[model samples]
Target chain A: MDYYDIVMDSCSFPSGFEHALGFKRVFVSGRDFEPANTDKGEDAKGRLAIGHSSKNLLHAARRFAVAVVPMNLGLDRAFIETLRENSTILIIPLSVTYGASSDFALSTNMHLASKMLAYANKRKVRVGFATMARSFEHMESYMQLIELAKLIGASEDEARQGISLAGDLFGK
Target chain B: MKTKFRYVLVRSTTSLGTIDEHEFSKGLMHYIGATNYFKANPRVVKNIDGNSFIMKVSLSGYSALIVALALMKHVSGKECGFFTIYASGTLKALGKHIGTPGTETHSKSSNDVDNFANNNNI
Candidate 1:
């Protein structure tokens, strides 16, 4: 049985988890924020609070073989190294909020994808980029997806297929 | 070492409305002044084209983002405009100062800039 670890913001996990039970395991992750368990000193307010609290739902879903995905906002080398060590299938879901609407975000996503691809390729691991279902209506999201696919050296057909698969999997 | 910049001036060639280099310099300076990293005086020089010129401004390593953001803000929605940036060292130092990504030093040379520019496509 294959598990589809849906990487997303903490706020969006409940809905995704509800739909993802057919998979072997449903993993929920927070986007652009560290797991609360990992950071002790930081204040958890607003999004951070939500991200920290979302893990509570994971306990309820544990009977259904659901798991909380570990997330970290630290963009340092240590974070990348930790990712390499974990070696789990990494799913990065781009969100519509925050910096995603800007050109800077587009370029940053491409850069990040390339780096992840390089790391994963060397380790024989699989990494995927997912444009959140919420962002399907935005042209910039599609454009960023295409750009990310190209930067990660996915064939055009592969890129299209990946996006199509994601839409089918999560789109309302 | 003082850094020199080659720049092009863009304006409405047919319209009577005009802006002097001093005005441009002051506008850029005022924008930079809002940030904590930029402190040096900007030297503006006219290009061969009357409407275009280059302004040289010095800033600390941490101010690159400020410059990039300022440039992006300034050039947005303008026609006949061109801008380029060059950095002397790693972005990690700057990232550290800004309390962001501090450990990684990704390349920021012409190739990366070109890739970014080509991706953005004006």
Candidate 2:
């Protein structure tokens, strides 16, 4: 099965990187909001936005075709259900976690990522895992992504599906 | 029962140059800790190319190693990223994907790593 990773814009991937990374497609996000690969046939109605707050996330979901909320804290069942209602997605991004320069930062980031993931799974929220890498150093291969997914408590099958969720967001 | 290891085929953005198994072990230990390191028993089997290599890690350490590989942003001050291409139970099985003419035998470090892991397990 094919897998995808959403990355921030770069000049371009290295030669043969797509094949080397084992991803059928790598969509680039032009900004922190909606990535450039999103279905653009629809105009402003489908703009993608990323929000950090429940209210802001809900607002973005209603204002745009797609709304992304980073999962970094303990979330209540009600808030997640409300996000599901608005069709918002919660994402655990590697960019935020891997930049940790200290052990404490890395541990904290890992705990938050895992907590968010476990909660999202329990809530059956549409959750995603992506590199969201702004640089090649931050980007990971499809298999590595799957491995990380498993590290964070996802089954092998669930991990594969999580990586592809970003592609689904791009409307592929 | 003999201890088995999973061989991981990986590629890097930049040439690894002189970086060896010891360096990989240190980096991984920093992330997963020495305990998980023994569980993983990761050894750099050999460099398939300047940028790609085969790694031998225990199944228990596979996930942690992968995450450590991703978490590692640099080596000796040079920026790089490691991408896992494939993994298999045996070196013979992994060599088929590496496209080498024949299976590469286990390196000395591989044997040492296995003994170390076996000793620790016991």
Candidate 3:
């Protein structure tokens, strides 16, 4: 079965329904942030957006699941407690500052990955870490991936192999 | 005789690479003077390699012509003038690397076009 991973955009979910239904493994990105306004009830527009996105993802993937990665620094314990039983939530610790130096970005991403791994182990949640494209340079991105692997206790070679595998599965 | 509008596809790039699909269609509708615009079934596909994807888009209604013309100006950056109207569609995709391809069409109405263009600074 084909596996598909998508970076969730609040605006693009409606147009993505059909393709989501056909993939075997679906990864919903940016699941860490909850609706800004949660008091409108279950049928609220914000909740509905996420609900619809998640519903389509679940329907599409034969082994459907989600990974919640905190976007802003608002990663609260309460929010983590509300996730569905099967969800894998990753908690990032380092600050993400855009327009920063390459070294700074890599270090921040690595630090966050390590912290997230430790938190996952503590909580007994089977979790994995991912970083955004630090920069457009291939070498820079690859280096960041290496740092992430080291933090995760995977060898550099293992990390490279996994990325290649992911590329084969979902890279264009 | 009914006036026909035309659009010339423009290219855009992002951190990942070039943005293959036209991001907004409503902008085109206002440029051509369309009253109401609507999209047909739209399909987009990105390759597993994270390189590129194919998108098929279509538009209909009397206002569609105006939208098409605005699209051409936005993409090609050329002012509208008396020119032969080409009815061929547009196709574009994004990837790690960039490449150029033929054009595609988006359906949108006049109001939708104005809002989209103004919002995007097109």
Candidate 4:
């Protein structure tokens, strides 16, 4: 079953969106940093937790079958290992930065992303890459991203599935 | 031994209005030349619209052709970006979806186009 762990934004609960997307469950994170005025609740279909750092995200990972993480923060081995030990699927958002600022950024490193997937595969952890192509360069970045994923561990079919999954989740 | 190739449908967006087709083609070749992906020039598939076109590129085990198309930044001395509208393992699927062929005389060589479009990558 498809699952999501969307970081909460200020003007919305994100709970309703989970229903709209037809996901089995949507775990809302980054809410611990929000003001107390924000609503909180949990039921059989959805759950809202106080998530402020990588630790909280790992805590949530323990409960769900899959964990969705922002790549910037989830790249740490500790965070990845937490989910890996639980056998939780790791769905990482893959964003490729370009131009002057991106030359030194680790987030845009295709080789790094590929190695992470390979590591996950070696540990028997199910992993997925979520990508959104905002421009042509971003599209190229995604091509590199998926190709690298295949080079490391993911098969061609798995790479295609990752692309389709990203399109469905982000409407890219 | 035979080599298999992949065909990519790249949709370009430009800031300087309609770009010259020849320049666009040349820019792509130049951009690919800078990368270690492929050493040869890819075949230019006919342009479907002012901004979108198709190209046949050699498949070298990975999505190198698509990756090259994605990295293109400038064509004809103007800034531009190429977005992938659709990528498939078959030309028939792309032709059916885009409602256009690789050539203007599409009706005559529809079979040939289908044959050429049949690449093993998606």
- Most lDDT-accurate candidate: 2
Q: Model-by-model lDDT, in order?
A: 0.34, 0.68, 0.31, 0.48
lDDT per residue for candidate 3 within A18-115, as digits (tens), equals: 13222222233345333321222223222211222333322222122233334442323433333334443332311232222364664465454555
Write down the worst ten-residue block by lDDT for model 1 chain A.
Answer: A65-74
The 10 consecutive residues of candidate 1 chain B with the worst lDDT sum are B95-104
Q: Candidate 4, A91: how far from true, in Å?
A: 1.9
- Per-residue alpha-carbon lDDT of candidate 3 for residues B1-122, written as tens digits (9 for 90 to 100): 53332222222221113322343343344433344443432233222112222323344432233223212322233222111112223221122112212111232223343454356443
Instruction: Provide TM-scores for the models.
Output: 0.29, 0.79, 0.28, 0.57
> In CAPRI terms, where does candidate 1 land?
incorrect
- The all-Cα superposition gives candidate 4 an RMSD in Å to the true structure of 8.8
Tell me the lDDT of model 3 at B63. 27
- Give the residue spans of candidate 1 off by over 4 A: A1-81, A95-99, A133-148, A155-172, B1-122
TM-score of 4: 0.57
Badly placed stretches (over 4 Å) of model 3 are A1-65, A73-75, A80-84, A89-109, A138-146, A152-172, B1-122
Chain B TM-score for all candidates, comma-separated: 0.35, 0.74, 0.24, 0.60
Worst ten in a row by lDDT for model 3 chain A = A133-142
Per model, how many backbone clashes are there? 3, 1, 22, 0
Where does the lowest 10-residue lDDT sum fall in candidate 2 chain A?
A35-44
TM-score of chain A of each: 0.40, 0.80, 0.38, 0.49
Model 4, residue pairs in steric clash: none
Best by TM-score: 2
What's the CA error at residue A8 for candidate 2, in Å? Answer: 0.3
